[model samples]
Target: MEPLARRTLLRSGLLVAATAVAGPALLTGCGSGEESPARSDGKPRRGGTLRAAFTGAGAGETLNHFVGGTALDMVRARALHATLGDLDPSAPDGVRYGVLETIEVNGELSAYTLRLRRGLTFSDGSALTARDVLWSLRSPAEDPASLPVYKNPAATFDFAGARVENDHTLVLPTLAPVADGRLLLCQGNYLVVKENSDFSPEVATSGPFRLEEFVPGEGCALVRNEEFTHPELSDAPYLDGLELRSLPDSEARAAALTGGQVDFAHDLSPVTARTLGEDERFTLTSTSPPYVSGLFFRMNLAHEPFRDNRVRTAFKLAADREAMVESVFFGDATVGNDLLSPGFPDYADEIEQRPFDPDRARRLLREAGAEGMRVTLTTGPETPGMVEVATLYVENLVAVGVDATLEELPAGQLFADYPAYTRLPLAASFSVPTPALPLYQMSYGGQNPAALGWDRPDVDELVATARGTSGEESARAGLAAQRALWEEGNTIAPVFKPFTTAHVPGISGVAEDLFEQFPGFSRATLS
Candidate 1:
């Protein structure tokens, strides 16, 4: 797969020109009947830059459809392309159909038809057609190495049979049926691009904003798409432009937030969230992250030490999850008890949090006849809350008479380049776009970059059956089977489900939607 570098930027004034239909809606103190006179009109106002501060080590080369890295990509892409469906990141089952008119799952979901609205154009004034979809899908198939997930069985997108049925419709022929085809379409994997567009050092995309200027390690600026049209967004974008600045350090990003140097900020911790909440100029909202962060182990069944499941169980018990969540995450994240997140409505409810007990961990190790086992725990710079968590893991494991060392490397080194069995792709750990297929592919699907060289025929069968079955009940059963398989295998240690919190002041339309960070921006207004 291509190596996309991490870009870093300063969190500064990111908002731009706006056209307000009315004045800002003033807010008062909690439960105060007296409203702030500054904000009265609730009408959708247009115009004002929406500057966002993000934290990351650095920036990568391509912002193209294929290069999925960093929060920068998400921020930039949301302004650039509109997906088939809109996932409101704030609430449950809030995903709304957007670009694609309707998704039909008849014929066991083996067949799907996507109908586009009458007029759809890219930022470059190029018309969006079914052909663009075909070209984009085929681009990944033609070069699976460039698109890592294509190698996984769960990444069962049908590029070969993707056809432009007509100007309005595109037909997809999957190898097997999929339960939630909409999940695949709406996720990050299906970003639409113009056919024949060059994706060399830079990427060109079709969205509401065009990438005007991008300084690799600093930030990016986006301008409005003159040819784009979407009635769903009332005052859409509300601004003439948007700027995303990368603030590499959390402290710096937090400082910028309180200084009012930036209009909005993401990835703040619970403490930061609290501090920002106290500010009169800002409001903070938290959402369950689509991504799941955890400790993944490469079990070398054929190699030394780990051939025994007892060793794995011991290692899992040694790590104190509650301590990590409390100290590192500041109680902002949910204890990761299961591989699947609650965001997936069909996800099983039984994957409860595995408690930490050193004695049990040690006993399990002794029972496995494991002694002096030295293993390397690899992590990356972007792994927030990882430093302390890793340290605690190392200490706890040592206390259990197990030898362990924490190996910290850049995210690109671990994930984008290395194969799944030996090292995990740390920076790209999130199974987002939708947690469903991404997790399915990462665990059981052979093509996943994160599969860790482990597979079960039964699990694969379950996933395949689920994909091929259009019935909701059958698909749910398959999902349950898949989740069960993950727990049984113990290949990856799911630590906690992180939360996405943002602090914004005097801004409306920032709903707690699970799919997208900023929803109804078209209907948003700023003072």
Candidate 2:
């Protein structure tokens, strides 16, 4: 009963969008007086270099996609290697296919067949095959340097039992029935490279851009692959070449864009965005609904003060969400409920917005014998809004009669070590828009450090029920899981905002970029 009905019950990004916060200042990726790529006049001038900047980890950055230390490292890897598939809201199947043309899943949800589009080739003109996909998928499990999340998922995929049916098709038997298997593998991170490809500049990659030069901790020089073609895009990679610059500081990134050193800046701070957004030289942009990031503050249950559920609830109730959104984002973002993945179908957004009530917070604190607890919120501007949100939350805590202070980590060190991050008493984290069930499975499934000590077997069972069912029944199970988590979850997610970036007016055709911040130059043009 293998069927191609994988996208029947759920759509990943194109699911219903959360209602936007009402204000003229709220900017959609293409809306709010900004010129969308589709509305631009004249043809895209196709032969100029597009230069962009993103934060980089000095000396620790690696081209190995399996262990990319910073956003810059991942961005460079995306430029140099082609994707297996990417989550695209506009795609019919919710995934923009790359080398792989189709994913066929069995009725039992126990197996999958990945068929590569025939005629796909690397820069060296070697035929790209199913074995290449197999290698790229298996490397994460075997590579010594791979991150735990990549390495840990190996248990779910029966790579050793997988078989290539042909040069272009591979059949895989799953270790467990994961209904969202396609999303698990095709979520824009599992790129397809030639087997044993060392990822050096000389290695033949299948992406739209070929690496011309690379310097560790710096960035890469890339040229368009004339032979490269996407299954879904027409004459992509409109630029002749691209230059990626590493600017770890958000202000420095914004400065590079304003000073004409680069054409685009990745993830500018809200303060910088407000300064440059109205300027004639730069155009500020954020992605459309459902592409936003969930800005969060988690109370580590492993630590003191936050160990009590009442105290955690008090922390959540004390947040001034409206102030956080208005002050940090300047009204460009949506206020978050206490839960994550609001736009997703099964997120239980019907659970109602968590209100800002320092009175309730104080009452809870009093009842819990913690009316004057001391806690420090460790945060940084990993993205634009984090630190500002932390500042406001700390202020709210002080108002609620708690001793809350802020600790700002350096730009690159906030998440440098996962275990250390989990051990912190109070912290900030963010989540990109993704399906609700899988979103939980990522962190809350087991002892994943990202979960921050949230381990609930009952909730896990509800998620299992959700995944193993379909339609309304699946939604009910998911909602039940979310209901339990929302009422008791340790994280205080305050706002949801798009991945905002500022670019010169001359840059266009990037609204469909894989990363909203670092425009994937695949379809972008520079005039």
TM-score against native, each model: 0.82, 0.86
RMSD of each: 7.4, 9.8
lDDT of 2 by residue, 1-527 (tens): 01122122111111111111122222223311233343246665667777777877656666776766466766777777788877765677677777888999899988889998989888888888999999988888787556555654465579999999999999988876767777767767677888998866688988889877665555567888866877776678778878777667777676556545567778877777787777766788777557788889988878777778889889989999999888888888999887887776667877878899999999999999998888899997677777888898899999999998999987666777666787888889777667788777776776556777887888887887787678887889899998887789998988888787888776777767665544566888765
CA error at residue 521 for candidate 1, angstroms:
5.7
Per residue, candidate 1 scores C-alpha lDDT tens digits across 1-527 of: 11222222221232211111021421222321122224347555556656666653355535653554555555565667665666544424344665667766555667778778778877656678878766765676566445455333225656666767797788776667676666666554355677876753345566666666676556766666666675376346566666666665454455655545556666665555666677665666655544444433444444456556677667667767777677766776666543544456545555555677889888888887886777766765353555556677677778899777777665333444434424431112433434554457544476344455455666776766765564675657566675665455545444553544555556666552224433323333455
Write down the lDDT of every candidate, Cα atoms only. 0.56, 0.75
Give the deviation of candidate 1 from the true structure as CA RMSD.
Answer: 7.4
Question: lDDT at 154 for candidate 1?
Answer: 27
- Please state the error at residue 254 of candidate 1 in Å: 1.4
